[model samples]
Target: MKKLLIVSLGIIGVILVLSPWILILFGRNQLHDHDIPQQEQLVDDREKHLILAIFPHPDDEVTVSGTLMKLKEEGHEIQMVCLTRGEKGKSSGIEDEVELAKLRTVEMKNAAELIGADHLHLLDYPDSGLEKVGLDSLKKIVGELIAEVDPDVLISYDSKVGLYGHPDHRLTGRAVEEVFLEKRGMDGFTPQEMFQVTLCKKQIKIALKLSSSFQKNYPEDPKQGLPRPDFSINTRKFFPRTLQVMQAHQTQQEVLKDLMPFHDKVPTWIYSRIFDREYFREVK
Candidate 1:
């Protein structure tokens, strides 16, 4: 029994020391298996660009926070647009919707600031009820903001998958695409590129197989595969700041726990080794 215990302890110690490297290998393998595209060559970092993000809720920005921080470091302006305050969900244990709204707004502002966002535009739309707002109405509201920002690049959730198949995410993505494609280069809205936040299909499959927490939780999506990412921004240097941006939304811990299960349990280096890059697909 003593010899068996000693051997088990040695094995555990080896795993503890090698886990980070193993995770890095796994991450690289996933990146390779998915055939993730390289960074776009035409994107000139020397020329300043206004990058705007549109999403349905406060914490949705988490998907792109690392990239935003990196861009800000590269002398680009970052703007975030949130369609709702995320008051409808009581995941925060706050029963009062009004109070929840107030808190979520503050959290979002702090998160945006931490992510180096220059502006955060808030639309007071009903949380979790975006479809009721009417597609045309949403297009008008989002169009007005696009005209005002005149962003060089616009980013939002993947229209086909919606980053776990959220209705609000899908709707906001649809609105942004329709509004921009219909009126580009006509009404002072000259955003040249549209990028959608996404995980490559292989990555999604791997994540789903590894974590039972996400099983049976996604809404039905007609799209057969997850959206493929065309660009990957290496945020390896800014992952610490990314954690801070994530923690800024304290009230949304429940939601984050599933997405980042090891964030708190593992050291930053280990966590960053696996999630060191943010993925996006540019709409052609």
Candidate 2:
């Protein structure tokens, strides 16, 4: 009994000594901007502009929903486009693709309504088969959409890595970025800036633990963590709206809960501490 007690005490002492070192080494968040008060100077409160986001799936816009709400409150128009209704994805063991497609479209619309998106465009594109649609064709369609919207700001995922290396997401982001490049300096019009959604190294590490989708899709390169965000949007002021947006996509509850297991079960403030910051890399 005494030997066991000594061993336990020694283990506790080692943990206590290594606690700060462990946190310092492993718990360091890879965000480029630390504790930005509310928002970046990129957005001016006085000027009204249109913000547009294009994603492959219904729930993808949740990434920037808080920023959308903030922009809306400041009198900016928000428009979200989903290239696919996420029919190819599984949710809650639902296997009927056609049924899930319709259901997801409805959920997307509901979330768009809650986001106060002035326009919610749901396009029917093959979900997981975006690559099959081919890049040039996708670019033509995306370019036209951008031309029509004529947004001041554009949003999409990281083209190279697509956050966690989702193939559809990569295609969507590549299409958006390529279109933006083509339209830039055109005679017509183009967005002043484009921002790509990204998760930091630490965030992806946490996500791998929670979501099997991420674990499977994430690159096997041990060194290839998600890019460090160029800046962080402090969305703490509008976390309530963010939570509502998260809840709007009931079909994606598993994905949301993976990030925060007790998200809605606990007080909103508790989760806001981790989620209040939205990360992005500005597209040049």
Best by lDDT: 1
TM-score of each: 0.87, 0.84
List, residue by residue over 1-284, the lDDT tens digit for candidate 1: 99999999999999998987987787667644446655633257978999989999999999888888888888888999999999986778899999999999999999998998999998789998988998899889888898788899989986665777677887888898887778777757779888888886666776576544335544345364457777787787888988898899989887777666668988888778777788888787
**Candidate 1 Cα outliers beyond 4 Å, as residue runs:** 1-19, 27-34, 40-42, 209-222
Give the candidate number with the greatest TM-score.
1
In model 1, the clashing pairs are none
- lDDT per residue as tens, model 2, 151-270: 988999878878777888888898999888767887776688888988766677677887777888888885664666777787777788777777877777887776545667655654
Output the lDDT of residue 74, model 2: 84
Q: How much is the lDDT of residue 177 in candidate 2?
A: 90
lDDT of 2: 0.79
Q: Evaluate model 1: give its lDDT.
A: 0.81
- Give all candidates' CA lDDT scores: 0.81, 0.79
